[model samples]
Each structure stands twice: as structure tokens, then as C-alpha cells.
Target: MTVATRLQSMQPTDIGVPGPTPGDMARAFRSVRRDPLTFLEQVTAHYGDRVSFPVPGAPALLVNDPDEVRHVLQVSARNWNKKTVQYGALARVTGQGLLASAEPSWIEHRRTAAPAFHHQRLEAVSDEVRAAADTALAAGLAGLVPGTGRVVDVAALTHRVGLDAVGRALFSADLTGHAQQLLDATSDAAELVVRLGRSVMPTARWAPSPTNVRLRLTRRRLDAITAQLVAERRSHGRAGSGAAYGDDLLGLLLDSGLTDVEVRDELVTMVIAGHETVAAALTWTLMLLAEHPDAQERARAELAGLPAPVSMLDHRDRLPWTRAVIDEALRLYPPAWAISRRSIGPDSLGGTDVPEGTLAIISPWVVHRRADLWPDPLAFRPERFLDPGAGRSGYLPFGLGPRLCIGREFAIGEMAVVLDRLLTTHRVAVPDGWRRPRPQAQVAVHPEGGMPLLLTRLRAERRD
Candidate 1:
């Protein structure tokens, strides 16, 4: 028999976990392909927290129980590695960078990259964010009457600001000149990654199919940008630090004695992950605010009477309500919706026997929406976060455990700065008869068809 035929016959029936039959899955294949989120939610809800799947060869389990998720991501993290199909696709683009790297080496990589994101260093990120935000506002939304709202694509605006901020803060380089080129390449790369994830039969990266060819070109363009960045940094000669490179992430990577190819991989990884994730967060936050004007106004009020031109760190604790709104947005629409891992060894999770090589998928999208974990899970209530104890468990927006996102603070601060600044000068509201955008789960949960919102410039007196 063929490989597919042999594997299909070897489906696990005694895993001590419940899941849809292969026939049921076959019937829902189209729906699953079109909208994985809905399918996942429905399956989890139907099968309870820990559900197995009818995949051949390797067993697949969706771990939705909070404790099971914690066990996989935190308690038994070492037993799980990023060797699954989800991260495998990411590794194709990012190579073995921190985001997609497995353990042992990833430990060293994290140590090497830590200093660059030190508390003091990241404080400077607010300045970069403010500068980028100001530039984006001037270029994208310059002419606007207070009441006569203009239809604006805030998603694109967030992408610009996100790329600019990451470039400045981490690389100590301005990326405004290469923003469109880089964004287009990264966007294409993300689309390709999603397509790979959706495919029933995996395509080899070496195969010269149309998708593979496009991905090759996209990677080439990204490599070209990476080369430009490295060359410019070399020419500038450390920018007054007298070190071979400067005291930024690039410098740290260089000092770590990594090879040129290794450095390129990390740079590309940062360029994609650092910007795209935060941009999605920022864009989704804007969409949430636009849909709920009361919540938006409350958040804007918290921004008022703050120290003039406060830095990101300064605004961290001061804007509790605003921060609450952001927290809620992240819960509702986490950028990295699914975090997947492969079982490196035999382990029991949620009282289910998960064999070695099993795929354990933890979806923050589903976890965040669990009514048992979160009361009134569907409603957009920022007030829920006002309690200090809230979101201590079952919340993994930036993920949980040692593999938690290194740039969590950076992204959070950047979002706060952009949201604060935008709220100070303009009121964002959904246009009349505006339909909420269904999230398109790609590299991140992007709003379908883009987020077009109405922007009304606030009068100076209203700011007081």
C-alpha cells in the first residue's frame, strides 16, 4: 500500500482520548480548510478540553485544558520541542532563529539576545515608537476634519509603524526607506506559510511549484534587505560606541560569534516576528476600540492628564484602564493564535496517553475564549482586567513558560504608545453599518479584508 493508505489504516483508537472520527473529519474538511478557528472551537467544545485527532502516523491532540496547557508549555516543556508542522513551516522562512529554534541551542541563543532587550535598552523603544507614530500619522492621516471622518485603513498604518519601531529600536537603523519592500516580502512569506499549513499533502521546499518559486523570490528579497542592513551597519562603524558593531540587537548577535548565515537568519526572524506580531496586536486593538466607542473614550480619558509626552515605560502603570483595554483586545484576538509542539518523549497530558511524536497543539485563541476560564468570554469588557488577579491562569497572549515571547514587553509598550498617541489626537470609530472583520488566521490573526475605520481628529480643546 502507499504511504497515505498505510498511515490511514494505523489510526490510533485506544489513545484514551476522544475526537472526531475520520469520516466526520472528512465531511468537515472544506469547513476546516476555510475557517480553522471555528472548527477548532467547535471540536474543543464538543470533545471537551483534551481532544485527539484522526491523523495517521503521528497522533495529534488539542490541549485546551489550562492545566494541560501549562503542563506542556511549562511543566514538561523540555519534553516538547518545535519539531511539529506548525513550527516546521516557520523554520523554512526563519531558519533556526529563536522563534523556531529547538532547545539546547535555543538556550544559548536566548542568552546572547537577552542583553539587547534589557530594561534600560527597551526604555529607548518608546522614543522610537513615538517618532514612528508621528511620522505615520503625518503621512497617512494628515488632512482630516473633526466631524467629517475619513475612511482609513488602520491596518496598513500599524504595519508601517510596527516595522519602523522594530527597525529603530532593535537594529538602531531606520527602515522607513525600505518599509514597503520589506512589508510586501514579509506579507508574501506569511501567506506562503499559511498555505503550507493548510495543505493536506505537504509540498517540499525544494520542489519548484508556483508557491515554492514565489517563496524563493520572497526569501531572496528579504536576504537582500538583510545584506543592506548589515552593510550599512558596517559602514557606520558602531555609531560612537567604538565597538565593532553598536550596542543594539545586531551588535549583540555579532558579538555572539555567530556565522554570517546565522546572523542573517536571526535578523530575518526578528524583522518578521518582531514587527508582524506587534502590528497585528496594534491593528486589532484599533478595531476593538473603533467598535466600542465607550471603551475607546474611557481609554482615551486615562491617557489625558498624563506627563506631557510620557515614554512607553512611564505609561505602563499610569494608564490602567487603557492597559486594560489592550489586555482585553489581546485576549480576544491573540496574534499568535496557535502554539504547537511535538512530543519528544512519551508523556501523559490531561490524563490522556500521548505517545512520542504526538502533535500537542495549544491554541490561545480557543483558550482565551473558554467560558469556564473567562466569564462572559464573548463580550468585550475591558473592566475584567481591572482586577489584579485576572488572567493569571489560562492566559497566554505572549505565551507561557520559558519559551514565552522575549519581545512581550516591547510589543506591549509599543501598542500602548501608539494607542495613547492616536487616542490623544483622533477618535477611532467604525463607519456606519460597519461589519466586524472576521479574523483571517495566517502567521497572525489578521482582520479579513483589512481594518477600515473612521477617524475624527479631536479639537485641541477636547484634549484638555
Candidate 2:
């Protein structure tokens, strides 16, 4: 059978049980303003694996069990659609992009975009990724006095790196000028999405509410920027082979057999999904490496062994320890922590009855850190990923099934290049009393105040 068909065929187990009432779910949503993770944990703890929560006028399911998550996200995915509560705002900003579209449209977009992110295509862009990382690293470490200790916001640095990588790899442009604005707009959009999650009713859009205003403004700003980029690429024409600038992902998409509106939607989706998640992933990875000296040392050793003039793309796989570090970090702090789907029909999952229109929330945060699947769930252990059999069902940083991130390979490739380069070029250390920064769930989970790290240049390495 075809992979998509096989995914559709897998059925959920009939394990229906009594769950938290709609009122309880609403109360939890209110509490999420104070702490989202805690609120989700409370629901899971009180209601077991599957719990029903009232969202606006509709009921939703919060599924924490791994098998059930698999079934919802992978198996029986045909019966599920992106919950409007979560994606409606996204659609406003991104239109029918891969992240916002469902069913046939999403499948078509995925198929068309798949070739742009193919392994060979990404490999071709490796140098661009490295150049971006190097630029960010140099700028971040610049103007620091010797032995004075440079306190760099690793999250901001990674954001810049991600933006640079995406711009160079996709559009052949430098995005530094628009970085802060894009970040702010993306953050606002994410907040608006979370707020709308509580009041799932479509009335909010027509009510002239503050949320609606914010949503419209954010969408306008983001689209203006995206449109400008698209226009510039179109005007420039494709760069010749062996030139510094060539027809990349953005160029390919512009040439894709789709309307301009469709291309714009896809571009916006790529900007948000491509840059934000990788930045968050890199930030978290650096924070973990800072805490675990032995792991840092091992990663450095792996980098040291690489041939001179190494880049993130060239020797990513060669450094297993570095890859493991990234894997472990993703397990603990997935940027795309929560995904929601609505049931198209009544179904059972993890022995629970799920009614039609029920919002099914699948959280990688809960599953990846489940004690049953991961020993010492809170610990930063990269070794777990080294073992092929360890926590297969529970680990899903990029997600699963047909809707899995198309940029998965590109993100990994970019990350490996950045991490390898950073480890080899400098030694990163956090402040003595610096606690693990709580992730702020914006478009992606980012360190609340940006991840601060002490970046020390390796004595043998000269600034490029």
C-alpha cells in the first residue's frame, strides 16, 4: 500500500473513558496565560491520556499518549484536520500555505515544495548556510574585551543566523534589515493564535475586537515584507551558475505552477517555519551544551577532527556527538511543541471516544518527556538518540506523517553546519547562576529574554 494510504488505514484503539468537562478545559485555557506547560500538564494529569475541553462552543481532545499521538498525527490522519482555533489566524497571514492548508491542497503543496528541499538541493546551499552562520558568529563575538567575558544572547544570534541562512538559501538576499520587524510580527501573530484558541468561535473576526485588530495588523506587516522580497527576486532574474547568487528555493517557488498569491503564502510559511524553528532549536542546543561540559567537550573534539575550513554542511554526520546534542535538545525543547487537529467524524483513540469536531491536541512536549518513554525525563542526555531503538514513538521534534515538516532536512543541515562551526570556533559557557530559560511560546519556543551565553574564542582559531 502507498505510505499515505497506510497512514490513513491505521485505526485508533477503543479506550473511551470519562474526561474533564468543557468548563474544566475553559478554566485551563484561562490558566494558560500564567503558564501554558503547567496548564497542559494539569489537564493531562487530571484527565489521563485523552481529555475533552470546551473551546468556544465546541469540545476538543488533549491527547498525550504516544500511540494515540501517532494515530492522530499519522494513522487516521484523513479524519483529522488542522483545528480552526489554531490555524485560522495562521491562514490569514499565510493563506493556503503548507502549514495552514489541509487535505488535497496541503498534499499538492507538499509535493510541489518537496523537490526544493531535497537532500541534494540543500547540500548545494550548504556554503550559504555556513557563510550566514559565520557572519552571525563574528558579529556576536565582536567588540568583546579579552577576559572581560562577552554575554551574548544566543537566541538572538541564532535568529540572525537562521534569517541569514533562509534569505541566502531561498531568496539570495540579506534579511538583517528586516529581522527585528519580522520577529515582532511573527511573535504577535503567534500570541494572537494562542488567544484565539480559547474563543474558537468565528465571531471574533467580525466583532471588531482588539485581537482581530492585532491579527490584521500583523498579517499586513508580514505580507508587505514578503511581497517586497518576492518582487525583488522576480525583478533580479535568476543568477547564472557559479555566481554568488543563484536561483534557490524562493526562485524555484516563484517559477512553480501556482498563482502569485499561492507563492506568497508558501513564502510566508517558509519564513516563519524555516527560520523560527531552527533558531529556537539552535538556541536550546547551545543552552544544553553550555550546561553539560562533557558533552560540549565531546562535540568540540568531533569538530576538531574535521578537516580544516569545515562548514556545518560538509561534516554534519561525521560528528555524531554534535548531532546527538541537537537531538537531545530538540527532545526537551521542541519549537513546534503543540499541534492541533479537529475530528471530522467520531473516532476512538488510545481507548477514548472522540466525537466529530473535537479538537485533538498532540503535544511533542508531553510525549518526548514522558517518564515511561524517557528515563530521567528532565536530564540532558544525548546518548539516548545514539541508540536506534530508544524512544522511537516518543521522539517527534519535527512531527510525523504526510504533514511532517518539508524543511526537516534543510533545518538539520543548517543546524549541523552552525553547531559544528560554533563548537570548533568558540567555547560557549553560561553564567554560574543562569537557570535553564523558560521557553516563551511565540511563533516558536524561544528563551524568554533570549538565551545568554559566554562566548570565548578558541585560541587556535582565527576570525575568518
Candidate 3:
């Protein structure tokens, strides 16, 4: 018998993971969509970890239990494919890149992209990264009315910096000019994707809805950017040799024998994934640091002893506190708040049988906040991560399983370098009377709007 035939035959009976009916689940879906981060907290609190929302298309199994998470994400990962709603919707923009691809293709893409992010290659990329960070610093620190106590939109600056770094890493180009369009367009696409993903009512992209129109236009603009870069790289970046395209993400994708459309899609994925997620992560970290001045001072003190701007290439090993700050921030506000998978065949989760095609949601946001996982899970404690051996089954900032973010080390390293520089140079604090921004779930758990902060240049005396 064929593998597919055997797997289909192995399908289990209907699971007893109790949840409300489709009608009630739709109401729950709407409530969570309103404020997903908070709604998830509320649901997990009242209903316990095995919360299921039985919507029309597929019933979702919301799991905060560690064993279930490990099973779905690791042990039975082959049966749990990325054909779920979130990945399907994201494939509209990213087009089967690492995160969205399934089976052999995903494995292939991951293999091709692995070497570029390997420690040695990253070490080689460090010089370019340092230069990129300098460019980003210029963009971030520019127009800051330093002595006059100007209110800086900290999140905006982080996006700019992240954009520049990813741009350099991708194609050795400065992408700040395309930053706003990329950010806004990504948000628009994500919002529409969520609507299509969750609603019992199906919406087609070909339909001429206003939001659909915007999505199309945004995609075309994004395609134009990727096309231009791909053209430049293929034309002048080695010609017939197929050697190297400046050792960036685009270069690696090009060398992998992917077609033009395939290359374009991966580029879109890299730009969108590489830029904004790190931006959101760093912005939240800085905000949290500002809220706790003591942590900020500790991170700054850690950085004081290390080399100023160059933290990559083995230099980052010294900045544990700085790394911890980013880690803790990621724990509290994981960029990818929810990871969904569809069971291709029979599977078991947290001791319950899962039927074919069930939607299983592993929420990093909810899992990170589990009171049983960490002491005072709600508090900002970077020191918790400082310990090498901590309760880790519940701590999934990037994710778990083979599908864990391939760029985790790169993103964290970039954040480490950027945060070290920012803390060394400034005293960051939230603006007076500014309320905490509500966490919204789209592609990632990003702040609903711009995060405003007051940044003062730290003087020599302020170091102590």
C-alpha cells in the first residue's frame, strides 16, 4: 500500500477534546479577534489549557499543555502539516518559502538556507552586519532632537533599523525607502488573511472587495521591489559563474535553482519575516526595559564591558544580560503568537486522539504566560533566562520542533547587537502618561499602533 493510503487508513475516531459548537465557537472567535492576546489569556484561564473552538471549517485545538505541544510540534510533526489556515493565508504573500512550504519542498528550502545562517557564515557576514548596523543607527538616531527632549517613535526606528539590516543581509541594499510600504502592506495582508482564515464565511482573493484590491496592489508593489533586486543580482552578481551574490539571503535563494517566481516569493518572505518581527520584538524589549529601569541599567552595564558596536562573530558571548533582555521580551510578547497545524492523519495530543484534518493551535503567547511554567509569569525577569537550565518546555519564543524559525539565532543576534548599542548610547523610557498598547494578533503579536518613547542621550556620568 502507498504511504498516503496507509496514513489515511490510520485515521483515528473523533476526538473528545471538548469545545462549543460552530455557532458558539464563531462568537468566541470574534471575541478573541477583538483582542487576541488578552482573549487567549482569558480563555486559558477560564477553560483550562485544552480549549477548543469548534468553528465550521475545522475545529481548533488550543493547547497550552507541554506534552501536547511536544507531540504536535516534534514527535508527530510529520502528520501535523502547515496546510492550516494561518500558513495557507501567509502562502498568499510568502509563496511556500521556509515557513509556509510543506514536506519535501520545505525540507529542501530549509537545507538550502541553513548554511547561510550557520555560525561560520554569520561570522563572515558580521563585517557587513556591522556596516549595516551603522547605516541603521544613522537612520534610527537621525532627526532626534537630542537636547530638546524629543519624543521618538521607538517602534518606527526599530522597523527602520531592522529593515536596513535585513536588506543588507538579503541583497546588500538599503530598504528603508520601502520600509513604510512594506510595514503597512504586511499589516494589511495579515489582517485580511486572518479574516479569511477564521470566518465561517469564505472570501476569495479574486473577489473585488476593497481590502482585496489593496492586497493585490500591495503585492504588486512588493513584487516590483523583489524583481528589481533579483534582476540586478542575476545580471551582474557573477554572470555565468553562479559563484556568490555578496553572501546574502537573495544570493542563497538564487543559487538554489529556484525559478524567478519562487525566488520572488522567498524574497517576500524574507523581507516581511526578517524586518517587522524583529522590529516588534525589539520595540517591546526596549519598552519593557524602560518600564523597569533596574533591568535597563543591568543590560547597559553588561554592554559597557563589551566592544561598542560590533557584537557579532563570537563577541556576543559576553553579553548574556543583553541576550536575556531580548529573550525575556520574546517570552512575554512572542512575535509569532500562534502557530497552527492541521493533522494530515491520525495523531495523539496531550493523551487525546486527534482525527484527520483537525486544526491544532499552539499559542506561544498563552504558553509563555502559564503560571505553572515560570514564577510570576507576568513579570519582566531577564534573569530567569540568564540561567542556562530553566523550565524550557513552556518557553517557546521562536517555536518548537523542526519547524522552529531558521532565523532565530540571526534575529536574536541582530537584536543583541542593536540593543547593546541603543542602551549604551541612551536612556530609553516610555513617554509620560502613555498607556500600554494593546497586543494585537495578525501575522505576529504586534502592538496595535506606534510605540512612543522619550529617549535621552546618556552622558558619561550616567554610566555609573
User: lDDT tens digits, residues 56-169, model 3?
Assistant: 334577888987898889888888888876787778777888877765678887887787678876666655565666666556666654453456778778877777788776
- Give candidate 1's total backbone clashes: 0
lDDT of each: 0.84, 0.76, 0.75
lDDT against true structure, model 2 = 0.76
Compare candidates 1 and 2 on lDDT and give the better one: 1
Measured by lDDT, the strongest candidate is 1
**Whole-model lDDT, candidate 3?**
0.75
Runs with alpha carbons beyond 4 Å of true place in candidate 1:
1-10, 145-147, 238-244, 460-464
The residue pairs that clash in candidate 2, if any, are 14-351, 15-351, 15-352, 16-351, 16-352, 60-359, 312-417
In candidate 1, how many Å is residue 429 off? 0.8
TM-score of each: 0.95, 0.89, 0.91
Please rank every candidate by lDDT, starting with the best: 1, 2, 3
Better of 2 and 3 by lDDT: 2
Report the lDDT of model 3 for residue 163.
Answer: 75
> lDDT tens string, model 2, 23-69?
44444544576567767777777777777553333456678888888
